[model samples]
Target: MDVLLAAAAEVIALQNVAMIALGLVIGIVIGAIPGLNVPLAVAIALPITFKLAPIAGIAMLVGIYKGGTYGGSISAVLINVPGTPAAAATAMDGSQLTRQGHAGKALRMSLYASIIGELVSDIVLIMLAVPIARFALKFGPVENFALGVFSLTLIAVLSEGNMLKGLSAGVLGVFLSTFGLDPLTGDARLAFGSQELSAGWSFIALVIGIFAVSEALSMVERRGAGPIERSRVRLSDAAHRLSREDWRHAAPAIARAAPIGVFIGAVPGLGSAISAYLNYGIARALSRRPERFGKGAIEGVAAAEAGNNSVTASTFIPMLTLGIPGDVITAIMLGAFMVHGLVPGPQLFRDNAPFVAAFFVLMLVTTALHLVIGRIGLGLFIQAVRVPNQVLYPVVLALSFTGVYVATNNLFDVGVMLGFGVLGYAMNKFGFPVAPLLIGFILGPIVEVGLRQSLIIARGDLTVFVRHPISAVFLVLGVVALVWAGAREWRGGAARGASAR
Candidate 1:
């Protein structure tokens, strides 16, 4: 009771509340801009937090994290360019909705889903952080390998009609990921004698290229073809508001994705990008009309936003309970904790119960603030789509290159971005799905590291994956999903052939 009272007193401070709001605004602006991601925002803000009180500093960072995660969906819906890597999944549907004149609806859904997901995950962190952290600790290399394989099977789902093209793109992504130095050996595998190649490709550069730059190229091509009618969001339009029916469709997806995000966040290394894609795949799989997924399904936006936003709060679970950073963002937050002389672990919780309680309160308060701010900004956010294509594309192009150089301080990365921009444009031209390639790239490292470690531990015995119950389950599920997807593709092909005959 004393702890609760103290926590309330700490969180109710005006400085803490103001700091949270400031961080959130900064986060949203950065996140909505193409090529500027959430981690960069956090990194930039880390220095400012050094001078504030511990609770106030940490609260501001938390606000940024939550806001940035949601902010990515804004540009994704408006421009078909994800502001963050995780928002790439949201772009699959949200972008389509923009083209279809439902940008307002998609934006609103993303906002609501983000708030709900963040709220649920924060509650979970407060209530079940320790237990969930303990459960996450059980995921060994073998289990992770199995999980990666299961995640890879999602490529088939994304591929659907173009199974061959999807698989090829996925394979290309895996091959690209292998170009970096070997994770275990530190020996360069595919550097091709270039010193710069030793570090492999920059993920940020690749993402900005494949999504933002490529979209700019497409916009240019569209301009050459002739004038195109762009979607405009009018305030009085019914499509701009979320109706009961839209909520009915999106609520189930949000409910399902929030927990998935929480679990993924509790486990170290599996970040928001993975959770976003996985939730999107799951939502499409369970939807009554799966065909609507890539064509502006409200549930798709909901799932992707919810899945990524939920990760924001749950990520703190491992850091707070086990002193383990869930991902790069939390790793930075861990530094903030240590800087404040608040070591996060079992001891810290016991020694500073009041502070811990206050932190949780602050998180909840941040979520409420996120909702209010997001709602107020919805009108302004949707206006991005109202810009002329010529102006918007050039600005986006300049920002894409500038952001990449600023983030990496390397000219080589800018070149890499341009190169991949061409690759992405060509892929789109050829009717290939880019999402699978991205999935493969993101999961390939995790799969490779886990497989190598498992093999080393088991003396090259592949059966070790099946020997562990958890790993075995994941493997079986992967195989089942692959086979099901193949069967569906085959049936669709056969039906097409029959109709042609």
Candidate 2:
């Protein structure tokens, strides 16, 4: 009871509240801009937090983390360009909804789902951190390999319409991911004798190229076409708001995704991008009208947003309970914790119970602030879709180039971005799905490293994956996912054939 009171006193301090608001605003702005991501925002704010009180400083960073995660969905809905890697999944449906003149509905769904997901995950983090972290600790290389395999099965699920093209794109992504130095050995695998190639492709540059630059190029082709006439939709004020029916469709998706996000966040290295895509695939697979996915399904936006945003709070679970960083963001937060002389292991919780309580309070407070600030900015954000195509595409092009250059400070990365932009444009022109390629790229390295390590540990015994119970479960799940997807696709094809006959 004394600890609760002490924590409450620190949390209610005006400085802490103000800093949280400031950080959230900064995060939302940076996150909404194409090419500027949350990690960069958090990194820029880290030094500034050095002078503030521990609770105040950490509160600001937490605010940024939560805000940035939600902010990515804004540009995704408006422009078909994801502001963050995780938002890529959101773009699959959010952008389509924009084209269909439901931008307001999509944006609101993203916001509401983000808030609910974050709130649920925060409560889970507070209540189950120790137990979850203990489970996370049990993940070894073999288990991780199985997990990666299960994640890769999502590519098959996503490639329902044309499995061949999807598999090819996924293979290309895995091949591209191999360009850097080998994980086991420091030696380069596919550098092709260029020093720049030795460092491999920059993830930020690739993302901006494939999504932003490619979309801009596609916009150029439609330059003569008039701007989107969103005003003609004649939506009433109530129509813009989420109805009970919308809740009925989206609530189950959010509920399903939140737990997936929390579990992924608790495990180190899985990251929000995987969670976002994984949840999206699962939601679509479970939906009665699976065809609606990738074509402006409200549930799609909710699942993606919820999956990514839920990672915001649960990511702290491992860091707080086991002193293990879940991703790059938590790694930076871990440094911030140490800077404040607040080590985050079990000892710190026992020694500074009041401070830990205070931090938890700050997280919940920041979540509420996220909702208010997001709601206030919704009107302004929706206007991005209202801009003229001729004007918007050019500006987006310049920003994509500028942001990439600023992020890497290297012309080579800019060149890489342009190169991939052409590649992405070609892929789109050929009716190929880009999502599978991205999934393969993101998971390929993890899969390779895990497989290699497991092999080494098990003396080249491939059965090591099935020998471990946790790993065996994931492997079985992967097989089940593949069989399910294949069967579903077959049934759909037969139904179509019968209709034609």
Candidate 3:
């Protein structure tokens, strides 16, 4: 109890609070912009956070996670464009609500749902992470290796529409991860003889490149596009407020979807975007007035927002407890934690309880801050939604370049950013998803280290992966996941072919 209070006191400091608030505002702006996202914003801010205290820096990032998740809905509601991919499902009902002159209600409901989802997920994280970490502590290198492989298999599941493409990206990511010095041997495998390549590519540069720069380049393609017309919104009267009927509909949807989001978030690879779609679909299936769904059902917005926002804190479960990042944003956070000499895993709880407590406190505070900031800044964000691509794209491009240069003080990193950006752009053009590549890059070292250590311990017997029951289960699960996704993809293709006939 003393430790908890001390941690709380540490996090409540003015500097930390101010950082959190600033992050919320920045996240909202970035999320409201169509070409930017929370991951990109967090990546851009990574270099900036290097100078701050750990709690303050992490609090700021947490604020972005909370606010950005909600911010996406602003553009989704006010305009037809989903500022973030997670907001895509929200657009179905959000845009419809706007068309029906209920933009204010949709936006407000989105805010409320997001807050509720985040709070619930935070509670779950606090309750479950420590216990899960305790259990994971028993895992040996073999088990950890299997877990890493299982996580890689999830890339296929994450691909959803394109399993092969996802796997290919994952493989490429793993290959790129091998660029640095070999762990078992000092020999450089893929450094291409460049001295800097010996250290491998910077994660920050890759993040900015694949997400920020690539997105900016895509935005360039739509340079001539005009700002979307503002939706008519009523905010002054009781009519615009959430009515009893609205609450009645939304409460159940939020209840149902928040858990779905939590489940997806606690796992690896599956992200808020998938949760939002799943929750939206579930809500539609359960709704008595299903026909009103895409035409502007309040429940639809509630479910999608709740689901998307639920991922905010729950993604921390795997990251904090197991050292496995659940998504790209958490992957960046993983980097942040490591940079601060705060390694996450079972030992973190035992060694850094105070910091962990403070981090958790920050998570809860961020939710409240999100509500306050989101309400006060919603109008400004709505207006930002109307900013032209021509204007916004250049600013984002410059920021991406500057953020990378500022972080590394090396133009080489900036060049790497631009190169990865082009690579990302080409990948997107050719129907590849960037998430797998990022995940694979982040997890590659973990997988390699675990596997090599396990092999060494087992005297080079590969069967060690199967001898341990936990490891065996993971290996089996990975195979099953691959087969299931492959079968589904094949069936989907066959069905499409049949339809084409």
Candidate 4:
């Protein structure tokens, strides 16, 4: 309570009006631009913020994290492009709304729903972090490994029509992760004797290749062949707000997605993409008119934005309390802490109570700022995509090249980017989902590390995984999911054969 009061005091001085307002603008712009992440913005600003007191620096980063996560939805909704994968779910229904002429209303509802989710998840993090962290502290390697497996299971159905390929991608990702020096053994695995290859692939480079450059190649292939651009007349100037019924229907969805987002985000290793997908699944599962989903359903955008933005802040809970960063981004934040000479752990919470609290306060402030920009600046975000694909495609390629350079300043990553882009475009062309590849890349390392650690602790006994109840439950669920997906695939094949006969 005292910590919050101090945070409020600091924020009140941010009553500076200019800094907060400028931060908001910077955040939105950074987020709307494809290939730029919250970390990029935060890293760029960190040196500038260093001049300020600790509270202000922390507050600005927190604000960027929150505002940037929401800002991506604006771009995703108006264009078929997702500024961030977290915004991919928003794109699902939001892009559809563009075709239906309710783009403005969809954007408005997404902004509002995002604000609601951010506020609710902030409350959950502030109030519930202790208990959750306490439980997480009890988690052994086996439990953690099983949890990682569970995360992979969520992507089983998400792989879409090519589960074997998904498995292949996942296994390859895990194998690639082994190229680095092993944590326990202090020895390299697949470095092939090159000092540079010892680091394997940089995370930023991989994301750029898969999300940005790959998107560029796919767009290039479809250049002048996409669905007609009749959507330019979307949302006449007079119709700029969500209908009462829209908000009425969206409220329940926002509520349902919030807990799911919070829980998923608070747990280490499960990021917002899975949370958004899960929320969309839940909203569709519970809807009276399930067929409305993916056909410009307002609920889809609302639930997705809610889950995505809320999880951005929610991931901090485990990070701050248990010293376990929930996602790679949060893990970077942990590194940011060490760079600032601040040790990351529960003790830091004690030493920097007010500063830590300021981080929490800024999330709410950023949400409010996002609402203002979303309502007013949304049109610009939408309009910016008016550039022709031929012109924009090069820009994406350039940015993809730049992002790759930023990681290692190496041309090898650029080559890798082009290769992955072609591979990604091939998969997309054949109607395969990209979600599994991403999930696999993100979770594979964790699963490998966890499984290795658990096995080492148990002297090579795989049975040790089931000794813990939580691990056993998750393993059981993973087994059940694999069985179900396999059975469904067999049935689908049989049905297709019968129909052909």
Candidate 5:
């Protein structure tokens, strides 16, 4: 309690509050832009943090981390582009809502859900860090491999009405993920003799190409010898506000997904993207009207946003408690911790309890700042969709190339971005869901590393995964989820056939 009071007092300073607000706004803007994500934004701002006092610097980063996670949904909903990879699942329903003239409501729900998740995860991080980190530490290679496989299976099946296509896309993504050098052996597998390929495709380039560049190309195709109307119309603030029904649906989804996000986040390597997709699948499966999903369902947006944002603070659990980096963002924050002469792990908690408490207070304060900044700046973000395609597409193209180039400083990445953009457009033309491909890409390496390591530990015995009780449970759950999805799809198909007859 003394520590809590000290931390609370620490955050009440005018300088700290100003820095938090600044970071929140900057993070949101950076996140709202395609090709720019939270980690990159935080990295860019890390140097600036060095000039400030330790607590203030950490507070700003916390604010950015919280805000950027939510900011990605702005572009995902309004432009069919995800500012961050985690927001990709949000695009499925969020973009549909934009087309249907509910951008305001979609944006509103995203902000609210993000705050709810962030707040919950922040509290959890403070209260349960030690126990959760201990539990997470128990996940060895076998358990991770099983969890990744199970997540992939669930995501693929939830890919909306066509399991075959979804699985195919997922396979392709996994195949693509194997293009770089093998994780175990440094030997290149499918680099096709190009040295550049050895490093693997740049994630930012792929994301920008797949979403931003592809959207721009589609806009060009839609140009009918004249300027096309704005895809998103300007709606009033009141129009954008969530209805009571929206809250009712979104509330439960946010609640369910928050804990899932926190759990996945506490365990290192899962990341926000997987959390978003996994929670989305769970939300759909749990919904009474599962058919409403992927068609601009409020629950989908809520789940995806909540899932991603819930990772914001909980991701620090493993990092702070065990000195393990939970994700790339926390990995960066780890540097900030060390720079301030503060080391993570059990010793730091005992040695710098006040500072740790201050960190916790900063996280909660950042959540509140994120809420205010998001609300104030939402209309400004929605205005981007109101710009005509002729004007907007060119800006998007420029921004996409610039952001990618700025991040990597390599022209080759620009080419990769363009190539993937074309691939994304082609996939869209073929009626394939892009989400599964992303899921496969993200989970593929994890699955590969875990399975291989587990096998190695067991001297190539296949039963190694089943030998561990946790791994065995996850594998069983994967099979059960697959069966449930198949059965549900079969029943739905039969019902549709009967109705048509």
Candidate 6:
């Protein structure tokens, strides 16, 4: 009891509060942007957290996770396009509501559903994680190894429509992660004698480059086009108290999405995007208003918002219990934690229960803060849209550089930021997916470390990968994905050929 009391008291320190607020504000703004996301948000914040205590570092991250999830809705409601993939369902109704002159209502509905979802998931995380971690304690290296393979397989299966492209990105990401000073050995793998290269690539730098710079470059292209419009916050027929039908329609979708979010988030590498899509599909299958799903079904919005944010809270499970990241954003956070001399996984829970518990409380606080402060400030956010692009673009450009500077404290990172910005702009123009790149930068290290470790354990026997059950599973999955992606490409080509005929 004394320990618990001290833990609670320690978490309430002023510094932690400030970190939480800082993370929340940055997260919301970044997440609200069309292309920037939570992973990028976390990555950008990592270098800044170095000055803080571990508790403060994680607290700030917790805040970002919460705010970023809700922030995505801002773009969806006003623009008819989701700022985040999770907001896709929100856009169907949110944009429709805007067109109906009920923009404020749509925004309110999103906030309402999102807060409930976030709070509920946080409760589940607090209650569920310890037991799961305790169970994980019984597993030896083999079991842990199997679990990692399982995660790899699931991730591979869901990779971009191109299995090869997905694996290529993931494999590259893993390999890149291996570049820094080898953990087991003092030797550097790929450092080319440059002092800067010895630090290896900063994941946060990569994130800021790929996400922030990439997105800003793309936004710059649209700078002369126009400014984004945002909606004010108000309750109305569109977002007022849900009717009985709304509850009846929305419950099942929420029920389905919430558990899926928790379970997938518990897994090592899987994250929220699939949870969002899976929830949408579940909502469609169960809806009497199935045809209405793509047209503005509140249930669809409910499911997507809930599922996406649910993962935000739940993804911490593995990171806290297993020292493994649940997804890319968590990967960035994992790096930040390690950098600060905090070990994540089972020991973290035992040694830093109060801090972990505090973060859990802050997760709840994030939802509450969003509802209270965000609701009050909705009008202010809307007014932000009134700022002309000529002015807004310069501010954004300046901020992008500021973000780069914050990471490396080096002007050289600014150049990397610009390079990625141009590359991001080119990819966007060509319709290449940016998510894979973000995933690449985050996951690259993990795959590298795991593969190298596994090989060493097997005495450099490539056959050992097949001999091990868990490793074999992932290898087979990689092979299967290659086949599937090939078949898909072939069919797509055949269709194009037939069309030309």
- The C-alpha TM-scores of every prediction are 0.96, 0.96, 0.62, 0.79, 0.94, 0.60
- Candidate 6 runs further than 4 Å off: 1-117, 135-186, 211-223, 228-308, 311-369, 372-379, 460-489
The RMSD (Cα, Å) of candidate 6 is: 8.0
User: Which residue pairs in model 3 clash with each other?
Assistant: none
Task: Report, for all candidates in order, the number of backbone clashes.
Answer: 0, 0, 0, 0, 1, 4
**Candidate rank order under TM-score:** 2, 1, 5, 4, 3, 6
Q: What is the C-alpha lDDT of each candidate?
A: 0.88, 0.87, 0.79, 0.70, 0.86, 0.64
How much lDDT does candidate 6 score? 0.64
Q: Write the per-residue lDDT of candidate 5 for residues 401-448, one digit (tens) a residue.
A: 988888678898999999999999998888777777888888889999
Residue-by-residue lDDT tens digits, candidate 4, 1-501: 887887766676744234556766777777766557776787787776666655566666666777777877776676555666677667767867865656777778788888888888888877887886676555667887897787677565544245677566656555655676776677887777877667776555655565566666766666784332435634455455687888777889999998878877877766776677667755754565545766788998999889887787778888888778877667766766765666657887889776678766766666666677666776665554455666656765676677566556788767766776776677667755555566566667768778999999999998998988999998997888677666755766688789999
Candidate 2 lDDT by residue in tens digits, 103-191: 88899999999999899888998889899999988988898889989989988888887888988998888788889678788898799
For 1-501, candidate 6 gives per-residue lDDT tens digits of 666566666666788777777788887787776556677788778888888887788788878888887887776676543556566546656655554555565566577667777777788788888675454344333334443444344334334345465566556555655665765676876877756666666554554455445555666666664543434433433443456876677777777777766665666554665556555545554466654654567777777777777787777777777887767888888898789777887788788766676666667666676777668756655554445557765665665567557546777667756766676566557655444444444444445555577677777776766676655665675566446545655765688789999
**What lDDT does candidate 5 reach at residue 187?**
85
Candidate 2 ranges beyond 4 A from true positions = 229-239
Clashing pairs for model 4 are none
Error of 4 at 57 (Å): 3.1
Better structure of 2 and 3 per lDDT: 2
- Highest-scoring model, lDDT: 1
lDDT of 2: 0.87
Residue 251 Cα positional deviation in candidate 1, in Å, after optimal superposition: 2.2
Clashing pairs for model 1 are none
Regions of candidate 3 where Cα sits further than 4 Å from its true position: 1-118, 125-130, 160-163, 183-186, 230-366
